[model samples]
Target: MGRLPLGVTTLALFFGTQATTGSLETASTVSAAAMIGMAAGAPLQGQLLDRFAKPVVIVCFTVLQVATFVALAVAVNGGSATWTLAVLALCQGMTIPSLPSCTRLVLKRAVSAGEVDAAFALDTTLMEVIYVSGPAIAAGVTATWGPQGLFLGCAVLVAAGTIFFVRVTGARWLGPDPGQAERAPDKEDLRPRPHDSRHWLPAGGFVLAMALLAAPFGLIECALTQFGTEQGTGLSLTGLILSVTGLGSIAGGLAYGTVRWRTGPARRFVVLVLGQGAAITVVAVLPSLGVVWTGLTLAALCTVPLASICFHMLDLLSPPGIWMRMQSWGAVANTGGHAAGVTLGGYIATAYGSGATFALVGLCAFLAIMAAMPALLNPSVRRPEPAKVGAHAE
Candidate 1:
């Protein structure tokens, strides 16, 4: 609920603004501002998790999100100026805290070491479901009920998600309380301790792997839209393509959950990367809408499995105290990769064309496979204990 409603509203606001103002450039600027705001606040939000109880932080951010949505609803209704739009976008961005942080906090406590992989796979699958459902709902609601309805619905959804999460997780008290296991040593702590530097190498590797895997996806959205347009459909059909890809992502995530692979996670990551690179390369050769659609679907399928591997690795490798922050950092890597990919993709698409852009993304995916090879060879990847010989070598 924390994600779905906000996701719906963000789409509604974005496309709704496009519908209202008929300015794609302006809408893109607005969305970029919001995303930049979200990215900038990510680390600081993680720092808050480092200091506060997970529940308190989640609740506080939810309230702020709702208030901002309410204000956004009013402003959009009143036909606010561009400055108003930019400010509200920034507000929305800052209030969108790191979701993986909260999820990591709960999972770190709930699951045993043996079950961590399954738990994180479940989490990744659920997020895939959300990605599929959110935008579809956004398209439906914005077309029918308008942006005002979208905002009101989002406000309610966020409120309920926060309440439900707190109840289920038994996080009633704020901050560190008695008997909580969160007092374990974190990566940021000054005091020297055993677990302090233990998981650094695996965690760093996990972050890098995620960043590499995310590169193509950032560019794919734009290229896919162009593909749709080239097939004689207008830009509006891009939503349908994205929705279809989301379904494939859902299937891939579920498949990852069910498969009981014997290979270690690092090796599994390499396999997933190979599949992703191959699928993305197919996108470059699609000659018709049907073929492009199939290619996009397969590529999305590749994405979810890679995401599951990365999150599961982080969960296994992170210390209990800094699990939330480690997850946040992973998210930061994904965000940074997306940003860089989008910038590069835009330049390539403009200068050469979407076909060239698709080829470049495929090349990036192939490069990701090579980038992860070293980690796959390391026996200590996702090891629970620090290597005595490489204690200082992250």
Candidate 2:
């Protein structure tokens, strides 16, 4: 909830703040810093949660997150050193709550096993809807108020959500499931048993796949803003384009959940990813924003469903106690991919243009899909359809 909106808000902040700052490059650097922090931050939080009280860990990080946002906003607005701005963003990233993973973890306590899939479907769908609305909300907030006000609003939202999530429910929300007595809180238990070294291949494969999928999205975010700017439509409208993509994804995710694939999750993964790559490439070739929007909508349709499949596969593959670790690593992979895309795309769009940058992202995604083919074929990675997927899921 808080995390999705914050991410899109920061994108608006970065794209919008370039006017006050000397160069778009500096703002991109600042956004990249946050991206790097997020790439590493969630996993760090997961590690801490393993040893400490959940509420304590979340509270401390939430405070740090707020302070970092304030510091970041000040630096960006005051025309402070770019390095300083980037550093604060990095600090802020460390505290960005891994809300999606948290929601999935807590759902069992909130609902029955049979209904968990429905809950996750609803959760993932709703999250996409938030992301769909995030840019629009950020644009509106910035227009009505300002980028600084937007940043303040983000900080307040994050702080409030973190407190509510951690305090309102108490220990049971964070406690271990009572029925799973065999699932001890041991580091070793997180790994796929009897195959400490072997699990790495599947894990690595998943990480890479997720990263590849995410890179295009990060690049697209930056590219869309630049494209909108170049067309004289303004960055705010570009944000609206993203909302359209989100709408497409909502439809796709819902459709994906209804259709039970005849093949395993891996097979489905290959198809969806390749489809996204093709669509992204189309986005690069097209000249008009309307055409790009069509391509973006097509790409968005595959995005969530594929990610859902990946997470579902990983959950099946993960050992009992290490669910947090596994999910954290996946988040790292996704964020890392996004960071690379954003950083690189920002640089390319600054140096060349959005068209060239779009091409580059499309090519990279295509290459990644080709690279992932071998990895997806791994025997250990095979799994039935995701629980939250269609009713026919095995």
Candidate 3:
């Protein structure tokens, strides 16, 4: 429910802006503005979520997000200037509820260490499903009722989802109660010490890795659209290919979750990243659409597992107090990477070709590996024990 509305909102913003202004460039800039805002706001919001109660933080942001959406819709329809629309879109992105980060925290608290992989896999798989269905629903809503209706529908859906989430999870499980501390005396010891700077290295590395992992996706998406246009295949075919990619992600995530891995997350993550890079590089070089479809699907198979492992590592490594913030940083890195990649990919596709845009995928993977080597080599970065029962609250 929380994420479902986002697809509608995104499409509504792009198409609504373009329809109103009659400028494709302006619409793209407006969309990029929102991505920028999201990247800028994620870490700050994470801190807020960490410092405050979950229900309060979520409720506050959801309301702000919905208001921004309505305001943007109104402004766009009113024939507002490009600057005005961009500012509103930025605000809308900034206020989006940090539900995914919160959910990961909840999962970490609720599950055992051994089960964390599977739990994260389920979360990733659900996200893939949401991505698959959300856009199709958005397309239908736009066709029937137009962008305005889509905007209104998104607002209602978000509000409903937020209310339900808070009522179900917030009331029953507030942040760590006094009893929790008594039950888990060693919790403080398990936490990363403030004085140990070494503990933060992995976090930095993880953020870089996440950014690199996401860049390929953004680049490929833009490149594919360009490719479709050049081939006269149109947006429908592009959308279909992306949907198929999502299916591959779902399959990979589900399979990864059920299995018990012999290797640690660090090793597995490295292998996946390298493999994804190679697959994409090969796919990009091929001129045939059939090969593009098959290659992209094969490459996409790594994405969800990579995400699941990253979250699992965070749960295992980060201190309890700042875990939410760390998760938020991950979100920030991803948003930033996608935004950058899209911008760069557009230029590359226009000047060079769509195929050339994909070559960046391999380069990003290589850079990410370099950036992560320090943390990956650190002896202190080992798998830790699972959370003690009742050690934390939602």
Candidate 4:
């Protein structure tokens, strides 16, 4: 539900801007404007869900998100000036549902820890499909109707998903509705203590891990875009490369879910983190477009396994009662990292060439490993206790 719009909007950002302005620079500004809202909203949304009823939190934001997005579609397609469009973009982000956090929250309650890997894997694979199809759908819609149609379609889908989600809760199958108030308060407070020095480390570590993990992704995406530019195929090759990578992600995520790794998660995390770096190196050093493409695909393939492991680790390690907030913090890390990666990668690609970005990305992943080392090494934090019966609120 969240992904439908996210995937479409990623590609639609360009189409929406160019539909009126016809400038890449202007397109970037528009995209950044949208990012501003998403960046500001996602963590806050996560915190709200942790503090309130899941349905209540989602309904509040979904209504606002839908309204803002519809208005944004109008503003962009109606040939409103860039500043107006930027304001609309911010509004859209502010109200967006922060679906990633919500979905993960649902999954946590839906499946046992043992079952979670498979659930996440299935979701990740579906997400890859969405990532591919969403852009294609947007492109087709834009080519036939206009950017306005593309956004309208996305807005409608998002609204439908939200509505369906709420109705399902009324039936009462998986997720709890009354939310966090029933939880044991001694353990589950949403608000953090300033004097709780131990809490601060985990917060910083989670953010750092998420940010570093995502940073390279952004840098590599830019590198791929630049590769297409160098090849004179414009943006066509970029999509092809991304599609191949998405396939790789699907494969890796499925495999990771299938195998129960014997090693402690922390150790496996280090290896996976290092593997991600190696994947980048493979793409960087390899010659021949075919080989390079394969390497990039392999790189994408490595992505989800690491993320899955990290997510599982987070689930195991988060303090009771505030898991949703921790998840939201991780979300913040990813959003911030991706944004930083794009800015840094664009600068590096401009000055040092696309090839240089591979090294930069690998370096960031390496740093992530370093940031994660302390947590990973703590034997006490390795895995969580058995599932408790009363964790979920009625």
lDDT of 1 by residue, 1-394 (tens): 7667645655666876676667887677767777777767776777787678767787788889889888877877777876787788778877875555576556645755444555677787787787677777887887788777787788888888778777887553334421135565545432223265635654566577677667677687767666666666767677787877788888887777665454567777776677767766676776466667777787778677778677766655555456566667778788778877788777776677678878877787666656555545554442432223422322
The TM-score obtained by model 3 is: 0.88
The lDDT-based order of candidates, best leading, equals 3, 4, 2, 1
In model 3, which regions exceed 4 Å deviation?
171-191, 226-237, 285-287, 378-394
Query: What TM-score, to 2 decimals, does candidate 2 have?
Result: 0.77
Q: Estimate each model's TM-score.
A: 0.83, 0.77, 0.88, 0.86
With a 3 Å backbone cut-off (N, CA, C), the pairs that clash in candidate 2 are: none
Candidate 4 per-residue C-alpha lDDT over 1-394 given as tens digits, one digit per residue, 9 for 90 to 100: 6568877775676777887788888778887887777778777876676666777778888888778778877887688988887787777767777566566656766776556655666666676677767778888888897877777877888888988877765324224422332244444343334355665565567569878998987898888877677668778888788877877887888877666444566776777778778878776676347766877777777788777666666655565556666666776677788999998999887787777887788888788977876567555345532333544311
Of 1 and 2, the candidate ranking higher by lDDT: 2
Estimate, for each residue in 211-291, the C-alpha lDDT of model 3 and write its tens digit.
Answer: 887788779988898889888998987888998899999899998877766466678778988998888888678857887
Q: Rate the local accuracy (lDDT) of all candidates.
A: 0.68, 0.70, 0.76, 0.71
Q: Please give the lDDT score for candidate 2.
A: 0.70
| Candidate 4 TM-score, C-alpha based | 0.86
Best by TM-score: 3
Question: What value of lDDT does candidate 3 attain over all alpha carbons?
Answer: 0.76
Scanning candidate 4 in windows of ten residues, the lowest lDDT window is 173-182
